[model samples]
Target: MSFPHVTIEGYPRVGANRELKKALEAYWAGKIDEAAFTSTAHSLRIDTYRRLRDLGLTEDYAIPADVAYYDQVLETALTVGVLQAGTLDEEFTLCRGNADTAPLEMTKWFDTNYHYLVPEVADQAFEPNPERILTIVREAADADVKVRPFLVGPVTLLALAKGENPLARLDELVDAYAAVLAALAADGVEWVQVAEPALVADLVPADAELAALAGTAWTKLLNVDNRPNVLITTPYGSLREGLKALADAQPEALHVSLAPSVLAEDPTYVDRVLEAVHPETTLVAGLIDGHNVWAANLRERAEILDKLQAGHPDVAVSTSVSLLHVPHTVTAESNIPVDVAGWLAFADEKITEAVALANRDEDAFARADRAVRTRAESERTRNAEVAARVAKLPEGQVQREPQFEGRKEAQAELGLPKLPTTTIGSFPQTQEIRKARADHRAGTITDAQYTEAMKNEVAEVVKLQEDLGLDVLVHGEPERNDMVQYFSEQMDGFISTDNGWVQSYGSRCVRPPIVIGDVSRPEAMTVEWAKYAQSLTDKPVKGMLTGPVTILAWSFKRDDVPVSVSADQIALALADEVADLEEAGIDIIQIDEPALRELLPLRKDARPEYLDWSIRSFRLVAVDAEPTTQIHTHLCYSEFGEIIDAVAALDADVTSIEAARSKMELLTDLNEGFHSDIGPGVWDIHSPRVPSVDELTELLTAALKHVPAERLWVNPDCGLKTRGYAETNESLKNLVEARDRVVASL
Candidate 1:
């Protein structure tokens, strides 16, 4: 039973035990030296390659040794020597910008939750540092694994970057890439995976022109002396417009994702791709899902592969994209029910499934079939009462009584200042704050001691805000581990793990809670914290809660039921929490739905259903507020151009969005049609640089041209949980001063 050749597009770099994140954080915190950090990272890379070899993938079938210092995009920049300097401090500052340096812009990685540092191109001849890629290849070869080096394609790299006419510098970048490719071939590497994910996105005329130029550049690279075989891989969506350009490039191989793309739903999409692909090229059919945690349906996947192989016997099997998006394995999850656990597949299990599919292993297919059946039965009987409650939800449960004007009049009685300033929830989870929580968890300190420490911290933060002349104050979230995990910890039907960490960004990780059954709040999640913070200040305190949509998006939700059902249950629980906070005499509540736009479907035709349920879940929690309660929601890491109408329909009295990165360019869509009040963030909190008062004033002035002065609120882009205390203080002071200036001008 010889199988078609199988390969992994890329493997997760956050070590099986998350050693990379631990090492990086320790080095950043000054707990470990650079030598120690590099040793740990290098050991993890060796271990990863050895583990893959043990899994029976070797020789030509082995995956390339693709490890990142932080993110793959940032790795690409380092490999190409794109930064001004190659020092460690310069690299760190490039990703996490300092006071004197502006960090590269960050965005969601092509419809996935992972964030990537966008490359910044300038007027310089880019040079290639083949040492990084060459070092990994040599390390993997030492472990007896033949590897193909991976690089982010030049076109995708340029398309995702910020600068003036980045495409104009394509020829120089291509030359650098060709040099790297030739070096890999010199090092005995036979194949290289050049990922061009931008090809899968919807391309405009400018983008298409860039794609054409990229194709021409790659064609030149293929002709380079001693160049390794190039396999262009595009994942996450269709390459409808860019496929012809890619075909014209005429690489040795091309990989296309079948799931989450047109090939899965429309047969015509496969036919079209086959028609454009060159006859001499080997087509790698991405049959297994890389982004999700579901076990592959091997039987169905085989059917699709059979059809593909019938036309082209050169087709191979692979994962749709990199397996970095999912957890490493579900084998360690002992608390979840066996039936549900059997239905789940993580990164490691997906790799095993891919090999089984390529070999057409009957025993593995039978086991998968049985597990699928068990999961279906388990899902049907798991929560009949909750499902019935969702089915019977009354009409208009998602709509608030009284329109914007009525709510505004009631809210005005609180007497907040014009152009009022507020910090996004959270001050800083400083070392002391984190230690207090860790000590409590380890039973090294008494619960009473922990509570007192948190209370004192809250008091300090409250006084700091008051001294800074802020109109609204937050408790600084000293006790919260994360926005979503905090509420999940207090709720029923959620399971959390000790080492379930997944990389959120460079040196930051999140342990996503698993929702196994019906969700309900056993007690109020945030009322005590909000009440305590309010007790210390005369100014209004915003009760913060992670909205239902964010909770659902961030958590490992139940698969037996639709996500909408889980979202509804969470919403009902939050609606109860909202009522409790209002009864606790809290006048303002902010429900942060930062993931609202991130969860929208990539395909335009499939967006309405998702938008409907997502908006409904938000409304279910927010609409229950009193007229004077002043419900607010915050969104981040999103562009509101296509979803502005849906955002307006959420009916929040006020919506604060991430606008500082694009300099409030997103407000152009809202200026003409949006009716709700807005707080277009006056400063970018993602960067470490403290914005000046003049900078904030300019942003406020820009926002005013869109949102009227009366409808505008002054605030930072997002939560302050990731910032330092000194920077947070300086930024907010500037924000308040900018607000005062704007009021005086009016």
Candidate 2:
């Protein structure tokens, strides 16, 4: 069969909404049988396919099985390949023996937080499971929807797989994957998309051997008897190599991302790939930004698509990346003014974009073009007001009453114990905690009841720390759904969605609130919780606040205003909270800015302005505190090697950062320039598996190599909210044991 002219190019069908999540939860809980679960899951796929089918879209099928236990499709690939280390298998195997058994660890997919399950190919007997793909195909078929199943391409899978030398088995693995493709073909799914996003990675795959491997994978997959059309999709980054092989192998179609920055390029990459491709090959052009809320430049994108089509008139339009990067729907953003809302395009709106571009009808194109115009106008209005407000900030708000030295003395007098043990400001949020919040949201429990529940958790956390012999205590942010979302909900300038869930990695979804106005604290945000928790123990309590840069980075901010303005507004609000906490006698505060590094300007030239605003915003919040207040900050998923100086510039009294998994590669950078006290996390928190006391002792020993033992604190890589109680408790016990060992050795 000929490849259809109508192809839909986006993400999977599974949504992070309440209904879908409940069904999956029930399935996991064994409350529903496989048949019942599969039925519910299939309905979602059918609904997605039907929606796109009604609009005449086809290239990609809305398959639910592509979504997995962990939201990462690559993780699904790993599971299919049976790539588990023996130890991991053993740990998960005895889950009933140890209720705190951590699940498989997932690491960042390249530099992005989109995590992929760490594939442990300890042996060579790994086999592909056709049932995974077949399940999706069968579901689509039952729904009467013609679907092309999607898989993370062999190259990408190999890139994400874990081993001493993952690249070593690339050829053999690609061959195995080709065989899997053949199987999918025989199953009557004619079309398949092998996503090789690793093509965009820094390692250029232009070598002859590399090209040969890519060619081998494509030709073998495409050569399957009665195979469906094969489409190679690569997005998020440009293909630096393999273009010639890709064109030469000549799958049914070729897809390339058309981001604003990429579109503005010399167009040479597109032209070369297009020119080199077989004349019969179709081109899928990405015409809309996926990761941001900025309205699509319809005229500009349409013009680019038109230009690309001038060469290959069979060009099809799609989003630059998955709509998963965008919010689920705009309808949930109730607080945004209707005029402003009109300027936005959520996932549903972007689907409309795909259909509009497929028709190439100028009239339909004009409506999108008008959306951009209205968006631009709205932005102009917003920027003018925001800029004026920023220009008039009271000068004192940006400066401290007393400088670092003066404040440091007061903090020391508070007599915090040396080598303090503290958490990253959250304890395990159990099923009970989640239910309480759910009940509150559903009105089954009152706000007061929810507060009491959260307070009880905080009180328990305080008691636990005292029992555990920790120095600094945290309020265990159980009341918050997400670090950024919680603050945004309370602040004056943000709007949250009930169903705006976007996958953070897999089943873990974060509904980052949308910041819409000048940020201001309506009242003291954390004083009550901080004070209550402090009252529970004589131990100094750390008041937790998400830093300005993080709140700006994590939330969907108004592009109409410069990020600096938005950040400053957030900083000002946080500044008020910091003052309130200090007045309420909270002696320690930790401002977490985990997303700061993620938000660094992609271009090197643009970084100074970003850093200036980012650092200023952090300082604006912290400078108001007396140095005696013991200001601490936490950074995550960031390699501080390049910007170590910038990190130091923030002058936080102490900072905790991810170090366990990073292998202390960043320690030397800190040793050279960092002046503040530091806590290089002694253990990896992302993994559910607990580290042994010996493992932590080694980690702490290595940490002391770069940082002085006296200046060091101990903590986990991140908050423990996602972890179960057993893992958290056991891990902390090991951490304390390791510390004691280190102390004894000294």
Candidate 3:
């Protein structure tokens, strides 16, 4: 049984896809020419393969084909013509202004906070991506490692494609995928794992299209001549509806998650899965902790495996999902205590755990079992302190200063615009800016040199904003690498990584710092940047900072502390920064807590306390300022309808939310009772697919239906840093034009 056991599931340190992000940014900055950008990307591809081999865990390698202009995997599929394109010339021309150069449309990847390039489908142009797969395999061969490269399965591709009715598109896409697989078989690649992860979504509960897409793709994949063994991966949860279809298709294997939640919910879910799977189909049991930072107990894992073994002795144990969700290594996190470090497992450690389980070395596993037990015992000692802290939370600690009316009265005295337009506080973080900062950190450049470069970037950003006629200008964040990370590095309580990379969305990754101890701001956080920007621009410069909830969400939070406690500590630090920014005469400080939605407790019972603390923390940070300070908060892709009260409780003067692509449905609730000022997005800027003035005009019109036109602040869905300068310029021009047209009509 060459069923080489491997686990893949870990959080990213920084952005979603780091190398690809670097390439795109380099290309945008013209630091390296197009050829050089492409060449460096090729080098990153080689580096990824080498890293996988260096780790010594290779049953599979997630190739960088999906890391592309929009997204790598999906882009490769589109470039090779797996999906059918419709009205391409028209939509392309509308979005990019050039039908000849209409790049594929990319959007957010379902709900998991990642984005992938959309597959452009066209029947006349179908070609197998042989070179991509071959190149990956050759890299593996060069490293002397046997591996299976990953591809987006047809079902998931079909589900995410652009069309009115995605279900109808599945039939043709299946055959396209089959042709691609057949070509791979001809190229002598005998094993591949098609990921059908979307089967775990809430939509899959009722959608039959998911099943049909899976069945069609798998049937074709197996039917290919001399094909590789196919392993269908459905991580996160059991494929509730598509299980039977997946079972019937019955390729070489079926991978199901055995994460803590999955195991606790229903032994029946797995039992049914094992029963439905064909006897020939091997069950790839995900036996390690892939999501959390805790080291897995071999004994606990063994017990779960024993249950699986009771049903089928031939079960293979692996990770719950790809290790791409977790940090790369815990080695460089110097701030975390060594004792705690031993109890935790990052991506690299999870790989070793998967190997031990799969190899069936009971004796070796027993030692790991004992080590985990010892660590757990030590952790048990700290539980009392954690419990004590939770019990001692003061009633006043969770409350804020004053009501919205009082704050608003004070804010009015400061004088700000009614329909104030602002950005989420970022300017183009160019290479020259980053290099100067890096050089300063390394002592190759003086503080004066670095600050001067940043000042120049800020001045340019201010000039751009004045030219564009934006109401509130940002300092362009030239001095900061990341919002949370920059602050974390400056403060004493946090620790960061040299090479710790985590995927944010697509190929853009961020190395979030680890908050290991009590967090306190030793000095002012963003006062210099805020003050300097204010100096350059007469227009109100919005001081930007990631809110407490976001810092907690983005960082590798300590398990020893409740999130509420960590949030408070961060809030205390940010509150100081907020005060300093206010003192510096900065109006419209936008505290972005985008991760607030992401950090919502998965279960309902535990949600209120989270909201109570999360909201109080936001208030703690912002409420201290006078009402006229214009305490703005920006959130994206958040469903705040249910938590409208909590949203109100934040007491922000303004909240810019994502509503453009998602049909402005959030406005329905906001219209009914939302008290605070709100600025819903008029168009999505994240996608390269630009909105037309008419499209945005209609969107703004709809936005005006819920929000008063006087209060409306037209802006893009999120930051435009990732977008090309050309696209950004064109899109903003359209947005401003649409706003003007709407205002004229009103």
Highest TM-score scorer: 1
Better of 2 and 3 by lDDT: 2
User: Model 2: per-residue lDDT, tens digit, 388-414?
Assistant: 656777643254546555665666787
* Pairwise TM-score winner, candidates 1 and 3: 1
TM-score for each of the candidates? 0.89, 0.82, 0.75
- Ranked by TM-score from best down, the candidates are 1, 2, 3
lDDT of 2: 0.71
Better of 1 and 2 by TM-score: 1
Clashes of each: 0, 12, 47
Across 1-746, the per-residue lDDT of candidate 3 in tens digits comes to 33444544322323224656676566555676768766666666556555655555555532222233334345446534663334423322322335356455545544344555555443334555555556666665675654565677767766666655554656566666676667667766666667777776644324466676667667766776666677777776666657888878877778887876556644577778767877778777877856556677776787778777777746777788766667767775675666657766777777767776766668747767765666546633343443454345455434434566666666665454545566666655666877998899899999888788888888887887777777777887877777778778876556666666666554466576766656777789788888888898777888888899988777777644566777877777788898888888887788888877676653344567788888877877875676567788888755667776667667687788887867788888764446677888876765677789999888888888788865677777777656655676667677777777887788
lDDT of 1 by residue, 466-580 (tens): 9999997888899998899999989876777655667778877777887877887778989998999999989999999899989988887665567888888898889999999
For this target, which candidate reaches the highest lDDT against the unseen true structure?
A: 1
**TM-score of predicted model 1?**
0.89
**Candidates 2 and 3, the one with greater TM-score:** 2
